[model samples]
Target: MAGSNFGTAAKIAAPLVLGGAAILAGMHRWESQELTVYADQLAGGLPTYCSGRTQPPRPVGERLTQARCDAIDAQTATEYGRAVLACIPADKLDQNSFDAFTLFAINVGKSAACGSRAAQLMRAGNREAACKALARGPDGRPVWSYASGVFVRGLQSRRQYEANWCLTLAEAP
Candidate 1:
């Protein structure tokens, strides 16, 4: 009877362990998909600042390849994801929230994201407030005004998406 009981416990425990692993794997895949979506939204290469000088421009039109653009996107996403994970506790965020925050960090710089009111709210366990805070800019103005003291439709759209993601639970892509 004892041996039979032990066998039943092992059967139950095994499924639980496997289910937990599958959930974790799904989360990882979801995070990767979010990164890819962000990269696609950002599009291909544009000159970035380096020592106050613009970096070399990427080949335009025919000279630019999808593979090359993908490589750049993947590299940039990986860097941003690492920076975000370093400063934020993974357990504190759901997949959608994590993706939104990672994108915000990518756009606004790691230090700014880490120090922002949104991050503070997240740390304080006020996720709903943090989601709302996503709409605010570094200067506490709306993101639309961050472009050039005028409302930018694109910025507003992006902020809306981020805020929505923060507020909703989304499935893995």
Candidate 2:
């Protein structure tokens, strides 16, 4: 029975690892798919399009097909996943950690994610510490909990989720 349960669990989890399903799901859940370009006040009024995309901002009034938007998201997620993987060894990363840090890099930037205390702990092979660092700074206040100089409840929630996700597969420090 235990073996069968293991098989069932593996079947469910395999696709997530193979297709980067965790990160994709997080992106879709948090970044609503938008067909038209608009200014994202959360992103400091940067022009955005197609599921929170800001790079090479799409001109206003331009619309994107669902397929195009999905493609862009997949491409960006892959790029950010690679950046996160560089901080921690692939062998040490599970689906949860991969999702957590990849989502973090996608929300923030590659440079910020790569230079964060979380990344530093990951580099030092302390997965638990890295996970804890995602939510709280040295002063214990939530990290990445503000936008445009104002506290954002949504960001705080996201950070808390990410930190919890990071810890799911990590061993205790």
Candidate 3:
């Protein structure tokens, strides 16, 4: 009943609705735990950038190997994630939004994702626009070639996920 159902689609959707449903039906209670596991696998646990690491750069549909992405994800959760959550407004966020932002924060350093123009828009209460801003990517600069290895691809996906999560809040009874 909680957590926006890619992340699920991408990571564990099959189980939630199919085979995984039994184990994850009440997973809302364990989202934080799941995040730690997820962060440890994808983002390098806050090491700075995955570009220089031995792992392949993140791309859509890329399958992250446990050996490569695991350590990074944990490092990300420790370094940037905790701080980002600390800064996020408790009243303004839900489990799904929190999950989405945490993942985005991992993709683009906490400072970049949380303080960029995009995040500013979200904080100012314009998530619809903020979601659009997420894909704009560093003044429309090229992510791979820019000084900031901070491209907006992965973060954009997370943003869209967050947007979807937030959008649903409006339809809630």
Candidate 4:
């Protein structure tokens, strides 16, 4: 306790830091609704932590190989994760928040959603505004696509849910 090295200090402080980050992240980030809906949009039918499509979009494990099959799974998740995380600057988000946010990013696609005003505002450190920005599209038009709106809403929901989960975890024995 008195003379701890990095390992001891890190073990003690890491949870505290993670808790604080989760609270801060939940403070202004998306909710579970946004994440789930967005996930559904992109997944179409798939669920969380998905891997190896039952009927892959393209050949795998045979011509391309099982490694490719697994790669496809990882690639999908990673792409979405990058997109979500990219929407917000690294400094602004904590670990748990980032996990939830990544769900949204994966579904919406970094190029499409992050390019929107929502991502722009989020990256600028105004997450609430960024979320509001999602209410509509670049055309300044109503969210004509239900899938689009659901995707945004789901992402928002997931962020909140993950943040809440972190809080719960922090309180656990």
Q: What is the per-residue lDDT of model 1 for residues 1-173, given as tens digits with 9 covering 90 to 100?
A: 65332111111111111112233232233323221112122223333321111124432222334455444445555565666667766655665566677666656677888888888777766677777788875466675225435576666666776777667754434
TM-score result, candidate 1: 0.59
* Candidate achieving the largest TM-score: 2
Worst 10 residues of 1 by lDDT: 7-16
Candidate 2 residue runs with Cα over 4 Å from true position: 1-19, 170-173
**Runs in model 1 with CA error above 4 Å?**
1-63, 137-141, 170-173
TM-score versus the correct structure, for each prediction: 0.59, 0.83, 0.43, 0.40
Residue 136: error of model 3 in Å? 3.8
Question: Worst lDDT window (10 residues) for model 2?
Answer: 5-14
Predicted candidate 2 versus true structure: per-residue lDDT over 58-137, tens digit per residue: 78778899999888888888888888777666655667777898888888888999899988877766677777788889
> Cα lDDT of all candidates, in order?
0.52, 0.76, 0.42, 0.42
CA lDDT, candidate 4, residue 42:
48
Q: Provide the lowest-lDDT 10-residue window in model 4.
A: 6-15
Alpha carbon lDDT of residue 69, candidate 1? 44
Clashes within 3 Å, all models in order = 0, 0, 14, 24
lDDT of 2 at 6: 17
